[model samples]
Target chain A: MARLTLDALRTILVACAGEDDGVDLSGDILDTTFEDLGYDSLALMESAARIEREFGIALDDDDVNEALTPRLLLDLVNGSEVRAA
Target chain B: MSTQSSTAAGASGRRVVVTGLGVTAPGGIGTEHYWKALLTGENGISELSRFDASRYPSRLAGQIDDFEASDHLPGRLLPQTDVSTRYALVAADWALADAGVGPDAGFEDYDLGVVTSTAQGGFDFTHREFHKLWSQGPEYVSVYESFAWFYAVNTGQISIRNTMRGPSAALVGEQAGGLDAIGHACRTVRRGTRLVLTGGVDSALDPWGYASQLAGGLVSTVADPERAYLPFDAEASGHVPGEGGAVLIVEDADSARERGVERIYGEIAGYAATFDPAPGSGRPPALGRAAELALAQAGLTPADVSVVFADGAGAPDLDRAEAEAIGRLFGPHGVPVTAPKALTGRLCAGGGPTDLVAALLALRDQVIPATGRTARVPDAYRLDLVTGQPREAALSTALVLARGRHGFNSAIVLTTHRP
Candidate 1:
C-alpha cells in the first residue's frame, strides 16, 4: 500500500461528501467539522461508506460518529492503512 | 333565511373558506404557473425519465422538471425529506405565506391544524432505500426510511416544521385522499379548530413506484403524447400517472374575516363521499349519489353548480360511469363539464386538491379552462364538455370530483366567497 498524501486525502474527502469544486477541500479547512461544512449526518454516513469502500478498510459506526472533522477521518484512514501493512 | 347556528367563531354551520392555495404540478411549480399552463391547454405528459422505464408497460407520466428543492425550500430541509415531502414542504410554505401566517407568526396562538393526504408517499425515497438494502446491506439503509415512506409522513413533518399543535391528521383514501383531506378539515373546523392546512402531495415516478402503478393496469401505454390521456373522448385509452400536489389553507370564515383576510378563494360549501360498486358487481356506480348528497349538504340543487370538474379517470368504463353520473344529476348537457387532468394527468391523491385550486380559480376568473387533447365528447353522452379552448361563463360555483381505484368516490362543492 502507498502512503496517503494530504492532497489525496483531501480529494477523497471532497468526493465522499459529494461536493464539487465549489468547496475548498484543502488543509486550511481540515479542522472544520462536517456540520460546519454543510454536511449532515446522512452525508457524513455516505462519505464514511465511500471511504471504507475505497480504502478497503472497515469503519466502526462509533468511529464514524466520533470523526467529526475531516482530519480525524484522515487519521482513521492512515491508521487503518498502517495496521494493514 | 337559515336555521344554521352562528357562534362567536362564525359557525354558520361552521363555514370554511379556502384562504390560500399552493400548487406544484407537472407544467409548473406555483399556482400561477399551473393555472396559466392549464388555461393554455399545454400538454404536460411526456416520456418517463425519472427512472428507467424502457421495459415498463407504461412509459409516460407527468414528471415535474427542473424542480430544485433548494431553490424553493430552506437549507435545513435539503437532507431531511424525499422529493414528495420536499414538494409538500414548499407548497405548505406557499400556502402559509399566502394566508399571512408563518413559523414565527402569531398563528401559534390559534388552534391550527394540518391534514395532508397521499396514496404514495416517499415512494422514490423508499425505492432508493430498498435498493440499498438489496445491493449493499441493511446497515446501508437510510434512517429516515422508517418515516419517509410512511403515509403519514407529510402530515407529521408539516405539523412539526410549522409548529402546528392542533388536530393534525393524514388521510389515506388513495386518489380521493386530497378531497377527503379538505372534507375532513371542513368537518374539523365545523367541530371547532380555527385553521387547517390541508392538501396532498404524491410522487410515484421511480422504478418501484412506476412498476406498482403499472401492475394496476389503468395507466396509458400509448406512446403518443397527444393521444395518451383523452379523458372524455371515444379514443380515451387510459389515464397517465403524474406526480405533484397542492396545499390550501382552510380557515373558519369568521376567523379569516377577523384576521382581515382580504381575498378568500372560495368556501368549501359541501362534501360527500361514497363507494363504487365492486368491479364485477353488475351494478351501476353511485357517483351521482355522492354528487346529489354533496349538493344537498350545500343547501343546493343540481341547477346551482355552474361547472363540473369531472373525475375523468380516462379508462373507458370509468369515464362512462362518471359521464353517466353527470348526465343523471345535471339533466343532459345542463352543466358544462371539464377534466383538466387531461393536461396534468391523474395525480392520484394530489388530483383532488389540485382540482380544488382550479375550481377556486375558475370561480375567481369566471372562466372554465378547456380539457386538453379531448377534442370531442363521446357521442353517447349528452354532456357539454369544455374543450379546444377555455370557455367564458358566469362561474360562481364549481363541483370537483375524484374517484380512487378501489371503490372510493368523493365530491366537493366550492362557491365563490360572497361577502
Candidate 2:
C-alpha cells in the first residue's frame, strides 16, 4: 500500500504526452474541456493501459476520457474522488 | 499491339496528380502548422519521454506531440484499432477533408484506392499484447491485437472507412515502398480507377520499437537534444528515430483537368527505385541505376530537377554513397539537397510520405529549407547541401530520393503545375 504524490502525477502526464501528444488530459476534472490537453479516445485507452500498469488501477478508457486531468488523476489515486459518469 | 511509344509503368493509365495534403507530424500536427514550423526550422527531436526510456541506448527521437487519436478518428472506432492504425485513420480523414471529401462520402464510386506502408506495423500494440498474455493469460488479450500488428492494417482500415474498393495495398515500406505505393496508385487509373489514397504511417515509440532500432545501430544516442542527430555534420553519430505517418491525395491528371481543380500542387512526373544489396557488399548499383532510370521514365534529364530531396539516412557511409549518386547524376554541383526529417527524426514508412509532402511544399513555395542540424556539410560530400534557413527560387521540378534501411532506394520526380 503506497501513496501517490503530485510529482508522480506530473511524471504520468508527461509520459502520456510522449506516447500520445494529441490527448487533452491536462487541466481540471470538473470543467476542463475535452480538447484542451489532447486526450482523444485512442489516447484515453493508451493512457488507461499505461496508468493501470503504473498505478495498479484498472480504469476504463471511457472513464479516463471523462475525468482525465492532473488534479483529477491525483484525486483518483488518493481515492478522494469518485468516478462521476 | 497498336501502342507505339509507351512503357509498362508509364503507359499504365491516366497521370495522377496531388490534389490535397494532410499531415500529423512531430513539428506540426496539420498542414498549415507543420509547414510553418518546417519553414521556421523547429526541432521536434528529444528523449523518449513517453516511457522508461532510461534503459534504452538510443533515447532520442522526433516524438509526436499534442496529437490525440480522438482528435483525428471517430469515437466508435477507438476501442477497435491500435495506435498506429488510429494514426493512419486520422491522417487519412484529415487528408480526405483537405481534399474536400466527406467522411461518409462514396469514395468507392470513384475509382479510389488506399496504399499505406510501414516497417513494423504495430509494435506498440504487439508489445502490450505480449505483456498481457504473459501476465493475465491468453484470454486477457483483445481480439483486435492480431490485426493491429499486421503491415497492411492502415490501408485496410482506410479503405473500409472510406469505402474505397479500387485496390488496397499495404506495402512493407522498404524505403521505396512509399514511392512504389504512389506509383502503384497512379497505375490503377489506367485500369479505370480515378483516384488513389496512397501514403505510409508508422509510430514506433514503444520499448520493443526502440530496442529494435538499438539492434540496428542506426539511432543517435547522445543526451544533448540539439547536438544529437547532426545529419551531414561530421560529428553526426546516427539518426534520431521519429513518429512518421502522412497521407497524400493523388489522382489522374486528366481527371483533375476535367474536374477543374485549380491548385495543381504537384505532379508525380517520374519515379525510380532500386536496392543497394548489403552494405560492404560492394555498394549495389541499384540506387544510381534507379535514379537514371527514374529520370528516363519521367521523360526528363538530370538538368530538369531544381532541387533534390535526399534520402539522408544520417549514416556517414550511406550519406556519402547518396551524395556520390546525386553528384554523378547532376554533375557534382548545386542541385540543392534537402532532408526536412533531420529535425523530426526518421519516421520509417512515415519518412517518404512526409518527404513527398515536403517536396510538394518546396515546389509550391519555390524554396527548400536547409537540412536541420547541419551548418558544415560532411567532408566527403560534394553536392550542394541546403543548410541553415529556407532558400527561395523559381522552382519548376523537384527530385525526391529515398533509400529504405532494408535495401530499397527510390527516387520520385514532381513537376509544378502552372496552368
Candidate 3:
C-alpha cells in the first residue's frame, strides 16, 4: 500500500464530515479538531475506520483517542504502517 | 361471569393508563398521521422497493419509503444501531414529547423503565454483515452486529439513552409480544414502578428477513395490490410483510395525575395470555380463553366492549380461528370488529402495539377506524367487520387481540379513564 498522503487524509475527513464531495482541504484541517469542523464522534469514528482500511494500518485504542485532529491521525497512521513494514 | 374473579386483581393493583403514544408505521410517521391514514382507509402496502423481490413469492410489503433516520436521530446513534432501533428511538422521542417529558425531564431519579418486544431485531443490519462475511471475510465484519440484531437492544438503548433505571426487559413472542409488552409494563407499574415505556418494532423486508418469512409460507403472493392480504375475507390467502413499531407511555394512574397529565388515552384495565392447542389436540385455539380472561379481569362483559380489534392473521384457517375465538367470547356477530392491519400489512410484533395505539385513538376520538382494503367478511367469521370509511361510535372500551406466528396468544382490555 502507498504511504498515507496529506491530500488523501484531507479528502477522507471532508467526506466523513459530509461537507462536500471533493473540496480541497490541503490547508489547516490538520490543526482543526473534529468538533471545530462540526463533525461529531460518529464522523470521527468513520474517518478513523476509513483511514485504517485505506492505509492498511491498525489504530490502537489509545492512538485513536489521542488522534483528535487530522495531523495527529496522519502521524498515527504513518507510524502504524512503518511498524508493519 | 364471576365478578369476583373479574375484579379481584384489578381492584388491588395500581391502575395503569396510557399517557402518550408514538409510532413509525408504514402509513405515516407520527400518531396523528397514522390515525388519519387509518381513518381514510388507505392502503400503505406497495411493491417492495428495498430490493428486487420480482423473483420471490411474496413481492409486496408495508414499506416506509420516506424514513430518513438522520431526520429523527442524532449522528452518534446512527453508527451503532439499525433501522429498527432507529424506529424505536424515534418513537420514544415522540412518546416522551407527547407525554410532556424530556430527556432530562427529572424522571432520572424516579423508577421509570422500558420494555420492548421483537421477534427479530435488525435483520437488515444482519443481512449486510452476512454479505460482508461471505464476500470479504469474517475479519471485515463489524462489532456493532452483535447488539444490533439482539431482540433486547431496543430496551437496552432506550433505558441507557433516557437514563431510565427501573425494571427494563425485552420480550420475544413474535406477533403477540407487542401486546404482551404492555401487559408486562402494567405489571411493572403495579409492582411500584412509576412509569414504563413498552412496545415492539420489527422489519423483515430484506433478503434474510424475507427469506425467513418466506420459509413460513404465510405471506401473500398475490400480484394485484388490492387482492393482497385480505384478512377475514373469503379470498384471504396470506398476510403481506410490514416493518414498523409503536411505543406507549404506560404510567401509574396516580402518578400521571400527580404529574398533571391531562390527556389520558385509556387504562389497561385487564390483560390475559394463553397458549394455542398442541397441533391436532382437537381443542380450539386459546385466543378465546385469553379474551375471556382479559374481559373478566377488566370486570367487563362482552356487552361492555365497544369494539374488537381483530388480529386478522390473513390466512383462512387462522382468520376463522380468531373469528371463532371472538364468537365464543362475544357470541355470534356480537361486537363491531375491525382489522386496521389490512391498511399496513402485518408488522409482526409491531402490529399489536400499533393496534393498541389505534384503539386508544379510537377511544379518544370516539370513532372506530375502518379496516382498510378489506371489503367483505366471510360468512364463517360472523363478524361485523368495519370497512369503507371510519365508523363513528361511542368507543369507550376496546379489546386488542394478538397471536404470534409461533402460537403465543394475548389480549388486552382498554377502557376510557374513568377517574
Write down the TM-score of every candidate: 0.85, 0.80, 0.89
Is 2 or 3 the stronger prediction by TM-score?
A: 3
Docking class of 1: incorrect
Candidate that would win on TM-score = 3
What is candidate 1's lDDT per residue for B367-408, written digit by digit as tens?
Answer: 998889998777788889999999999988899999988889
Chain A TM-score across all models, in listed order: 0.71, 0.53, 0.72
lDDT of 1: 0.84
Best candidate (score: lDDT): 3
Which run of 10 residues does model 2 chain A get worst, by summed lDDT? A17-26
How well is each residue in B57-163 modelled by candidate 2, as lDDT tens digits? 76888888787876666554655577778877878888877776664543444467887787778888888889989998764565557577898888888887887
TM-score of 1: 0.85
Return whichever of 1 and 2 wins on DockQ: 1
How well does candidate 1 score on lDDT at residue B385?
97
